[model samples]
Target: MAGALRAMAGPSAQPPSAIRHPPSAIYNSSRPMQLGTYRLIDRLGTGGMGEVWRAEDTKLLRQCAIKILPANLAADPEWKERFLREARSIASVTHPNIATIYNIEQDGDTLFMAMELVEGEPLTKLIERGPMIPLDAVRVATHVADGLAEAHRKGIAHRDIKPDNIIVSTRYVKVLDFGIAKQIGGTTDANLTQGNMVIGTPHYMSPEQAMGRSVDSRTDMFSLGVVLYEMLSGRKPFTGNAVTETLLNIVMHEPVDIAKAAAGITPALADVVRRCMKKQPDQRYADCDELRTALVKSLKEDPKLARQSRIPTIAVREARRLEPEPPPRSAVSSHPAPQPTPAPAPPARGTRAHRALVADDDPATRYILGSILQRYHIEYDEADNGADAVKLLKNREYSLIFVDLLMPRVDGWGVIDYVRGHRGNVAPRVFVVTGVQNQKLSAADQDVVTALLYKPLDIAKVEQLVQKSA
Candidate 1:
């Protein structure tokens, strides 16, 4: 796994699959694992099904991607055959925007499939620059939509479509990881696990997919709609404290309107996203082709979109363009411009109703929150654990409380229940803070808490929350 991921930072390209050597050769790995003739150079990415590696096809003398299942999976004969059958079926797909599968091979217990090594950053990383410039986002989506259209034509439905699975290079966008793609009219891989369980990540799955309902190309469209929504909003359409909670949100709620979520996005672009995200498959574009056509047509018809597309990278617009370069300084003033005077500190938390509290096992986290709150002229108290937080809440009322979800005793949830259950009318609004992944909030926490923020907090959003509370 280490060797495979090492290759992701350096992706090398070769000629297309049309001109590649004939397959099959057996070779064991020495230092760098080698299966058959394809010497595993590095691993590119991994998922629930399998992990992909960057390999050097010694016979073809070209670089390619090889996906391999876990050794434990080979013991299950039914699963092994299903993997091979699915790999062969997925290999049939061929498109510029889609990674081409080269060959599937079994060496001892190791089963692998060689494929195209996409040289670029995942859209997930690209989005960290903040919400994308709308046009560049649409252009990237159009490329993926084109690939989906082709797959739909071949009677294949890519069950998983997320920013993590899509690559965006300087020149082009490529869709990847077809391991979960199901054949339209054949044995669908809908329920690989017991009790007819649905496969695919929750953050990007359609409501129907989340509910274990039959999915078609429109299922992929719904996922694509989520990716587009994230690209424009810097956040997924549906998110909760836990995966099950997220799925419930997807099935039961409509996302906040995109226009209100992000500035600079036009009504036309927002409408297109809304249409693609309609919970019912019937409400969405009839098919991938229709979705692709709508995206392209929208891009052409909107003048604002045309100008935005010319910018190329989405991050550039967000991190740079919208703010624009500052004017050249007037050759340093003879006397520095009068220094602004600092404002006087306000009174302590004990004196006001706007008092806030920070609860965490770590003093450093509590300190950071204290610093931010202080700068905002908002006085706040501190609690080292959930018990202390509950004690403070029981005795007094506060305007806000930032508490860690995981702690030694009576964790974040304990404090939340105490305040909501005990304090009721005069309880402070809760702001959950935690480093723990897969944290699930109680129903009462949702109603009582103002928001849930992960550890290594987003300073800007926190400040906004402070201002909102103030």
Candidate 2:
């Protein structure tokens, strides 16, 4: 896998100077494990599916990644066929953004696959810090959509399109892992397990996929929408505590408004995500080509993005535009100007009973609540997490509070504990606002909150809550 990944780093299949090399321990210098014309040098990773190794093609004088079926599972005929299916899927398509399969070989009873080495981190790693710049996110999505367009044209539907399966190479955005790819309108790969169960990653599964129904190219589009949403918002659109709950969310719920969830994103770009995630496959773009076109148009319309038909090496860090130099130290003014007086504080909160606090890690949720609070002429304070909400509680007493159940540092439950712990004659009304469903709130949970409001919060209900509290 390391060799294949390295080849993907650039045209030369070498890691860029900026990328750090793996630990020396990752490479085995003992004795080269030879198979056919390839010498395995490094163990990249291992999973339930297969074990990947970085190998040198002695005959071709090139490097690639070899995926070996685990010895334990090699005897299973179904697993063996599925392993071969992955190779066929990759070999069937040839595109700049799609990883290539060079060969599939066997040594005695052991079978392995040699594929193009991609020397870049997965998209999942890139998004770990936070949401990406909107333009860059759009660029990556557009490139991925373009790749899927080609695969779709060849009648292959990549059922799995999560960020982990997409590599952000120095020269291109390459989609990897076609293990679950299904041939459209084919009977062999029906997207089901032995017991009529669905075969797809839970978080990104489309409605049809969640239901274990027949899927087409539209399924890929839905998964892509989930990825794009995560790229823009730094979070998944559908989530729950358990697998069944998550599947339920995917099948039954609408996600928070993207325009509201991700700040500084255009409504047009959000609309593309919206349409792609429609529950019905027929309601989505007719094909990936249409989806790619929409994303490209969005890129062209974004004034901040450089006008280009093709995306540059996305794995490369964005060059920060240097700030303009401050007017060369003015020789005439040796001393700094005196600071201005601070503005007066607002009216005392003790006299007003309509003050509120909105605490949620998501900027979009805060934005929505803040806007709603303003409509009712109620002053409010915003906290990005629970700890900050606690700090705000100490200074002022708000009549109402809207808090998300999950947050960084201290979660929403902690905020409720602080509120309930420091009980006063005039207790503040705490509302649990979140995307997570808790239809049967425990007695303790119900005691702390006045109400449990689900996400995509109803504007009318919010307004009513504010008006009544005020």
Candidate 3:
């Protein structure tokens, strides 16, 4: 539950008041701490906001996270108000991508807020593993932008949008800990004061934020850009040996080009990152929604994400379905009940509409590649092995075939030979996918394959190839 309910930053540097209350009754109890209807099962974490507990609601029998205000802070009206403000900020918006706030309750001196207990690793942990495949990075960024767009629409700006505040689950991503979120155009408060405190993680702060200028929705975009850059390169865009140096870098430095940082990242994707991290807020994406669109357009699907992310294929399908469909034109039935046109034969090679065949023994690869094709409204079929692919090719022609070089039964070489030898005129463009690094194809393979792509495919490159040929 600590993974689910961890809070932002640690306790404040400000000293505790002279009159400290006795050890709270909530913790002193031998049994699990009971705060009204909630049974606090265990302490999850502690931060400046206070302690987080994994709790169960007796009435609903549902698991929840309880963020309790520190006893010392609860005694101070200003701190108490700030804690309540965080709760209110989260409660104002109900979105699938944003964590949910259930209710605010007080148990005598112990005040707490109940919320959804998210189950996932933090984006920080994912980044620690290594740079994510570019497609996955964009997919996560798209979800984050979507959540931010909703919050922005509600006139709230998540002042702290960093990897530590994002949770990535198999089913979906959730933006967490809006403790520092501010309502756009709202009156000045504690956050804006200079020297006393600097809001947000320094490496992710926007130039405007670093200089203590007013902030709006665009501030979040800059932070998101830093995050996306890290996801693609496994490095923060702005960094320093010290906090002040980092802040100065944010204020005045240009980050190393993403392409140089991470090889093979598509230009279109790198541009999206560039636009997002523009020093001036006005120069960044107009809004998070626009950023989300750019992110989706930059790439299609990642094979690794498909296999490991656990994000359902339906999510991609539904996202693609967002494009407006042309309305059906009125049609009059003819008098003689004209026989429906015979199901048209599958289009011949090079004559087909956007259609593809994916042949791979790995079901995960087939699933993801098919999902990408589906997203682009391309018709496609799958074959687990090369022989089935050859059989399918014999009956139904496809404009594109993505075949693994190695497979059970007939190998890719056989499939290529069948296509090259039998197909008289127009042969489907065949792309070879293999796990071998620095693989050197023989002269024969060079003649047969349209292109050779290594394993853990670069999805953007795949998308570009598909768009150009399919």
Candidate 4:
């Protein structure tokens, strides 16, 4: 997982290393060495909005981290408000896991913030090296969630909670950069966003965030789920070739299961990950507190779970590719398998010799899928239940499989478990397309399923996704 994900670049899109400030002499000649009562010692890091520096609070004779808002940005009244809002958001949350904000400074057009100087490394850097020690992974997530729980209780939501924004010091896990935090229940008009635009990093965003919906405390839980998965699996939960595609993936796809990605991930721990990442906000943990309690229980039940760290000591396992098999005739036909008025020739398979399969008990749904596949010129097979799907899967390697959660015989989740655990099984991208009310996947299924969509299936999205693979 780590080997495959080194290419991800995490949520910040920054390299998995902390910014190393150059000599103070570099900034001394041009940028002001002093601002108000603090003297800039050196830069800590920089973002689109501004740079942070290791500064000395000459008035108090103490060291602090200072964030400076860019002059260009300060020129914009809206940005100025957001800058001040950022300060208030951080100041509102007082927790061991959250960095403290001391004061906001306005030196003429230059605006800056005095904050705690954390001597630590970015969690992204640790992730790049591979997964963490299991116990450490749980502790890091629990501590952060606990902190966010308090902030949420205070009606604040940290919209951006990703690896780069997290720092792991020798003794503490500190969440940094609340610059995107929003007051819970704040109007859409109150959002720092320009217009109705959504603001967040695509990779870790919740489906609601991805769709630009009204977000709440659960939004941070979704992002935390992404962080936890990456910490335990050594890979981001959702990823893509482009930003829009990644956002679409978050809203439209299910990530590979963590237990599969890393050997021996416990059911309890996996459940925590699953609930935290539910696409619908209502499907996730009620709040960060609930999430924290679950994390705590998981640790209490199996202290040895920590001993089975997915952190690879030898070589990082590059995720295996899915196998492509010949098409098979589906058993237990539902709705008499849709037959085109005029029998059409089998759709031409792509350069990749792969058979796509659709397994669902619903005759109408199967009919729809069959028709769409025919129009897209993609050859496919169908299964009416989990048992038949497994039988077909065994006979032929599939390139893609769309499964229904509540079919007779074996369930969708059972099929996934079987396929994933099968020896030398080809890794076909599996999607769950169902009308099951509030369908919830087992922790293991979360890692096995590729994408999920609620019925009535969006034929257009199905066409687009299938065509790309084709």
RMSD of candidate 3 to the truth, in angstroms, is 15.5
Superposing all C-alpha atoms, what RMSD in Å does each candidate have to the true structure?
A: 21.3, 21.2, 15.5, 21.2
**C-alpha lDDT of candidate 3 relative to the true structure:** 0.73
- For candidate 4, lDDT tens digit of each residue in 1-470? 22222233233333212212233412334678899999999887676347789999999999999988767667778666767888999898899789999999899778889999988889999889887645557878987997899899999998888998899854467998877788998763433454233455768888876666678989999999999999988898898886666777787779998777656666888889988999888999988888988887775444334234435522112111121232343575332222222234332343324667899875545755666566545678999999999998888777778888788889887888877887243467778887654778777787778778765455446655665655
TM-scores of the candidates in the order shown: 0.58, 0.59, 0.63, 0.60
Q: 92, model 1: CA deviation in Å?
A: 1.7
User: Which candidate wins on TM-score?
Assistant: 3
Off by over 4 Å in 1: 1-32, 78-82, 194-197, 306-470
lDDT of 2 by residue, 383-448 (tens): 988999999999888888899878888998899889988856666778988765555667876877
lDDT scores in order? 0.69, 0.73, 0.73, 0.72
Please list the residue runs of candidate 4 whose C-alpha ends up more than 4 Å from where it truly belongs after superposition. Answer: 1-29, 188-191, 194-197, 306-470
Worst-scoring 10-residue span by lDDT in model 3: 1-10
Clash count, one per candidate: 4, 9, 0, 7
Candidate 2 ranges beyond 4 A from true positions = 1-32, 194-197, 305-470
lDDT of 3 by residue, 1-470 (tens): 21111111112311111122234622444434898999988887655566778999999999999998866668877667767878988999989799999999888777889999988889999898777776678878988998999999998898788898899864468998876678898884625321255546667878777666689999999999999999988889998766566666787779999877766676778888999999988899899989988887666323323222322233233333442333343277222111122233345454554468899875545756776565455788899888999999888777788988788899888888887776646767888888676878788777778898775565556666665563
15 Cα displacement, candidate 4 (Å): 13
* Cα distance off (Å), candidate 2, residue 179: 0.5
Runs of candidate 3 with Cα error greater than 4 angstroms are 1-32, 190-195, 300-470
